[model samples]
Target: MLGRGSMLVSSLFPLGVSGRRAGVLALLVWALVACRRAPEVSSDEVGEESSPAVLTIDAMDNEQHVLRGGFSVEAGVFRVELYEGSVLLGEALLEEGRWSIPWQPGVGSEFLEVVAYAMAGTEIRTRLDFQRLSFTEPEGLYAAEALLALPTEPDITTRYTLDGTAPGPSSPVYTTPLVLLNKRGQPAPLSLIPTNPDTSPETWRWKPPATPPVLATVVRLQRFSGETPVGPAEARTYLIGQGATSLPVLSLVTDAEHFFGHDQGIYVPGRMHDPSPEGTAGWGTGNYMQDGKEWERPVHVEWFEETGAPVFAQNAGVRIHGSGSAALPQKSLRLYAKEDYGPESFQADFFPGHPLRDFKRLLVRTSGQDQQNSKLKDCVLQGLLRETRLALQACRPTVVFLNGEYWGLHEVRERYDEYSLASHHGLNRKKVVILEGDGLLDTGEAEDAIPYAELLAYVREHDLSVPEHFAHVEARIDVEDFIDYHVAQLYFGNEDWPENNIKFWRHRGGSATPGAGDGRWRWLMYDLDAAFARGAEANSLGRLLRDERMAEPFVVLFRGLMTSPGFRERFVARFHWHLDNTFAPERVLARLDATVELLAPEMPQHIARWRYPESEASWRDEVQRLRDTLARRPEVMRRLLQEELGSP
Candidate 1:
């Protein structure tokens, strides 16, 4: 016979025993089982046999188990242990016989295990089970009408939404493969509109819809056992495109670890407030894809674009080039193709068979200044300078993609360096001397700024009004290039000038002739982001030229040249010529309108991604401000010039 406690222990483990040994074994088993159960006595009115503990997973019938969800056991479970393979994930205490856990599985893990613990009398019981799962997202471009079959397992149902909305239980259930299409409908056929009044009818070409067909879908899937939901819902986005555009797409792809992980990544803006250190050292290696072809070589890429997007999927790199942007967020970027880093040349057909194809360094400029000026300031300024036979960098606009994501519009610009001078002027890179606005010598054998410093000293000490001094100043610089450079900067009201954003290069051996090895300083167009109305009023340049408070060497040189009758005459004549021809209101407005039209379709996405304006109307208002500036600036500049320098 057994005591009540002994009978309870015997009932818990079903041990058949007799005499003193049975009592001893019962006590030992009772103590062992008691330690695992809750101290508080559990209700037994329902009877242990009547409501035996049962553990079950409601939603885990799928092969790819999500890392989140709910679990249940028949009203008596006190604790649940979760694990990924052999690694213990965590434990949860059940409330009212149910427990929910947020399962955070390691990247690439495919299996999960759950163990539920319940107390019956003095015994602790457990139910162990496992589920297979994945969190990898689907990638690559998809066409319209393409069928996408999602990975699944038995008893699992997937829900998805194509309108870029998050999927929930009420979303459409996935019964079969999804057929993607332009839910908004096929794009209207393009109409040819002649932009240039002078353009012949035969020259007009069909323009594709400015906005391409893009679809982004989110999928949420859950496993179910009969009517009960199991595990957590797993969700991811699928980005698809209908067709490729004529515009080249530059796609950069990298591992999540390198891109999102801490240390040595571009996303980490270490010491952003200071600009003392020449170059911050956080570069990652990634593959560059352009025009549907991939470059397997590892390129050192960094987060370059700013203000628009945080953690831009698209990065910047140089191929055999050096580094060098725009809006406050629409800043500029530089890329270098150094020999030690990777490939020395970007031999793409950017300008097929042209000298630009083998560029050693490139500049990516954001026309943030254009938005403030006329939405065409930099492009129009560069074009005007080129038309006036001035040496200026060439630039073209292209849409950029980062890690297979659209990164808005960017202009590919020629970097100002020894290589640029060599390529443009057919001069030897070793013999080029480039001087920056801050008086630093960018490239040369001599580290000192002897040549530029001497020129500045000469202008300050001697009276340039004298023909002899004026002749010497002209010898050191191309007089025509200097006049045209000043005209462009002043006419556009570029406030960030003279003291900053200046670049001048000279060939060591050439004469003043174009492409000659003779050395005479020529200005380079740079940082027009601050031009137009962003930094200066229409008459700001004229005011600055006359302001004695401006004491920079470039300003001093300009003031000195203004003292000479011949120099002033040439300057006034050149200004008038540009105002009438290059900066003509009709021509400039036409270019502005064309740029606005080209960017109209793309702006919505760009603004949406960057969150620049409060609303689309605000963006239009900003663009209108540019147009208003363009409409009013030419007259303001003409009036200022007439008042300050006297009418030509």
Candidate 2:
């Protein structure tokens, strides 16, 4: 009879281990039989209510006696069970309010659940109480080495991959704690340089870096039940005493196939190809042209501040970014946050003096057209003009790590869109209208382009010397904003503009948020990499006054506005104010020197990684050239202002 009862208990609830399966069942059956055979004591005789008795877990220690814990209850037999995420680990019956089961947990086992139930006077052993416990968090950057101790469980196997790949049965088995150490060394001198000094990136030839990058151990661990994986894989990156950097660091981890595989990889030349016009080699046609959600890949992003303390680590989506630069060796990537990936917003203060902390999208930029030049031109120009009325993308230079390999320097910038405007100026995103070069609608509805088209027509038909005619144009666009925008671009000698890279926005709704909701157009400053490339004495203002390349509407608007005395006076005054303050030789050179100092430490490894500017010496020469341009630009612009506006 006892054997039959024990068999029933074993069949009903099996303890996870095969050896303890019979033992746990027999113990529970004995406890039940003892409760039944003993004389029944009434609730009144025990001086307790007829209601069910409460159970309390007093002590638990898996290390001391395999798996054991003490419980207290009102005069009744009880049974206990321990579980690791629904997998039954052990079961036992109480002996003098204490129970013990033969079980041992794996390393890094931080959480567990224990359940208690009455064994007597219950149709079946129903759980009356349960408690969950947490030990310690087990993922972070370590100074020396990390002991990667994974949990050990029966039947469930633990596997891991050190190359940032997903773990499977064929991967290395985690039997003991792994002792991981840093494998970083000083970067070797750049042996390979771009052979053609005057060729474009599309026709340029180069090879991957010959030397390996600074190293970190990225362990991706997964537990398996039979052949199926249990839950998501766990990952941790160990820096292992890497040297600190003055700039922040970004570690991006993803599957190797997603980044380097021939057919699917975005970085490689892959299947698609376009023969270069020069016919030397194909320039711009490739798999990198792929865009949209279909091309977006999953990635784990970890950010560490300049001081080496981690800020945020989360999963996000990434896609190739930029126009022509997308085809470069180190491509720019646009990162997105969505519910499908993880969080919907990256919460952090990315730029100094910026109030908003939530960002929906960001750019991991390779400095666009300036990737091979100073690489600081775009960032420096934008930073100088941030106080102006024009909207601009904020930039923060950071070094990146792909898997465990160094990816070199890249800027983390805010992506411009309706969301960006809404965040910065507190306007309704749906009501914002953004148009690019020549009235092409970049954001909002197609109908949003109508107002700009009408404004262009109005400027072309009427003479802006008439006060009413100029007022009509002023009502449609913020004239002061236009002045500031033109001053900054013209001062920087950005030759790409008035025709290319032009962007403007306005609120479609009524006034609600001060200057932002006034339904007047405002300009955005970006892609100033072409700035300061021309000599300091370049006559950008004179070129804008009468250039055949300028579109009809832009030419008509600028020439027409200059005809008005009031408009000319305001533009001259604004230009002088900026030249004295924003573009002062001392102020501009100070910012340039500070930026160079910040990048000096990382430029060696970065130059070796990309082989750009040929060598560190050439890069420094380019930076010095830029410094000379800025130092002389203010004086040159004042002379040009007299040439264009005549004795302001």
Candidate 3:
């Protein structure tokens, strides 16, 4: 005869693991039987007329032992306390004979104790069972049909879905093991298949498909007992591909409950489904999967990726990475590779033999500003910036997965910091001085700002129209970089500029190499998310150049430079050169179209996952808005420039 716990384990076989691995089943059964002993009833323990006996305690979902859902208790108890060993996990209040409590089981919490106190002041203790679900077939690159099976539990039905939707009681029920096929609806050819059979009269050859098969399938499973659901649904995505292409696919897998739990997951705070203002604090950490192993946690991260062959994998630290977009449910992320977190580098070759290899930080940008539409604005602007030879971060479009669930499209970007300066310019991290708007020092000594502050003070005090004072100001800064930076910002109509998102860096002292340690401030192009307005509005170029209220130090420098005849001539000539070349409609639109082509195929999948648009048509409408801005922005700027600084 089976113990009560053994009977519970036997009840889960119907949840779809019977024909698969036998060892997993035996282990799970043994675990459940050993952990779920019945409550101890004292000899004096008795129920009064007002209080019923504490009958049974069971996990509402019998699929896995990690409790992330409500539990059903057959007790007329008023209160229940749950514990892991001696530590109290949670407590619940019974209402009208039923109690529901939300609990997150800790790692290695094999058995949980549930202590119930009846209305009659009698207490009984029972143990709740737990077992980690195992994916019988490993998740990775597959050339043939992949088999997916779970350990069998009797009297339970498993329902599943493959369309990236969460599985529910109404989803397709699994009767046989799941077989994932390629696009051709055939099994991937095995290596043992003979190209030429011994008995064949003619020579035979096999030809593979021209394009490698790309399969992004998300499988979610829920267990059920007859008409009632037994446990919470578990899901995983199987991404199979030949190799990394121009657009690499990143596959991230972690525990489902940890990624989606109500209290602990990244989506729990203010993003995802919660609509309250308080939910905005939704930053959390989770394990990053790479090379077929779990990386563990305390590396803060925000999930938004779901498929393709993983080229780069790391067990590095991560954090929610944007200032403006961080509040959005679909937030950006920053990954760090540091000694404190166990890894000193992100491991996989993200850039592969590039200068970026030595850098330890990376950005996963959602393009959230334009997420509802084109999703190409920032990429397009950065591409143009690179063409003009301005120092800026590099970007690559990638599809991201969060714990095997499709997160949508993200741009892998280079983060600008001490590491970036060291990698790109071959400078010492400790000696580099990075300053934002108004000479606010981000790195190096706070005293380093004295020179920049003096320059700003000189621009305010002296007449820059005087060649001597203008020359003095020019010596303190990189004139050409400042011009290009301002041109790019004005052309893009980026409203967050001069006063916001501006960054410049310089070495602390003079260098032995020519132009290396000039101590002159050079701007770094970044955060162009607020550019390329879709509608006709007054251009910011004219207003910023002429507005006295916009007294940001950078703005003051630009205005002071415009006061000089030589400076104005160079600025105007540079502006027109960019207008006719870089920002020209043909050139700009060509770049935009090329980006759109690369991103179009993946946009629908991204949209489907994030609900960023009602349909692809809506997405394209946003793209058209960007196109219109690119086509008309140059003329608008030219007109604004002529009006503000006189005809070039």
Q: Highest TM-score, which number?
A: 2
What clash count does candidate 2 reach?
1
Q: Name the lDDT value of residue 475 in candidate 1.
A: 86
Distance from true location, Cα of 623 in model 3, Å: 1.1
Of the candidates shown, which would achieve the greatest lDDT relative to the real structure?
2
Model 2 score (lDDT): 0.73
- Give each model a TM-score: 0.57, 0.74, 0.60
Report every candidate's CA lDDT: 0.52, 0.73, 0.60
* Ranking 2 against 3 by lDDT, winner: 2
- Model 1 TM-score on a 0 to 1 scale: 0.57
lDDT of 3 by residue, 1-648 (tens): 224433454566546653225325544564555557546767676552433355334323222222321222433243567777788867754454445455544445556677765333357777654433334343443333334465457778777665434556677776544444233222222211221112222211222223322444456666778767675445555553323333666554433443444434443231332332322233221211111113223332222223333234334555566554543445576667777644576534455334555557788888855665677678778888666647777777887755433456788888888877776777787788888888898787869878888888899999999999999988888788888988888887776676878888888875656463667888888877778652535578776777777866668888888899998888889999999998889988899899888888887656555555546898888788888878888788788788887865
Per residue, candidate 2 scores C-alpha lDDT tens digits across 559-583 of 8799989999999999999999999
The model with the greater TM-score, 1 or 2, is: 2
By TM-score, how accurate is candidate 3?
0.60
- Candidate 1 regions with alpha-carbon error over 4 angstroms: 1-240, 243-247, 255-261, 270-331, 340-342, 349-355, 368-376, 511-516, 534-537
| Model 1 C-alpha lDDT per residue in residues 1-648, reported as the tens digit of each score | 223444466576575654345445656665565566636656864454654445543322122322223333433333466666678767653445555555433334444556654333232333233222122332333233234455566766566544323345565565544433232332211111111112112222112234542333334444554445555444333333334333333333333222222332232222321233222221111111011112112232322212111121112242212122110233344565655544565444353233555667666555654432233457656665656646676766655543334545666677777887787667788988888865688778675468778888999899998999999998888889889888888876776676767888788766646543667777777666556655225566565677766757668778889999999999888888887888777887787677667666666665554334434577677667767776677777777778888864
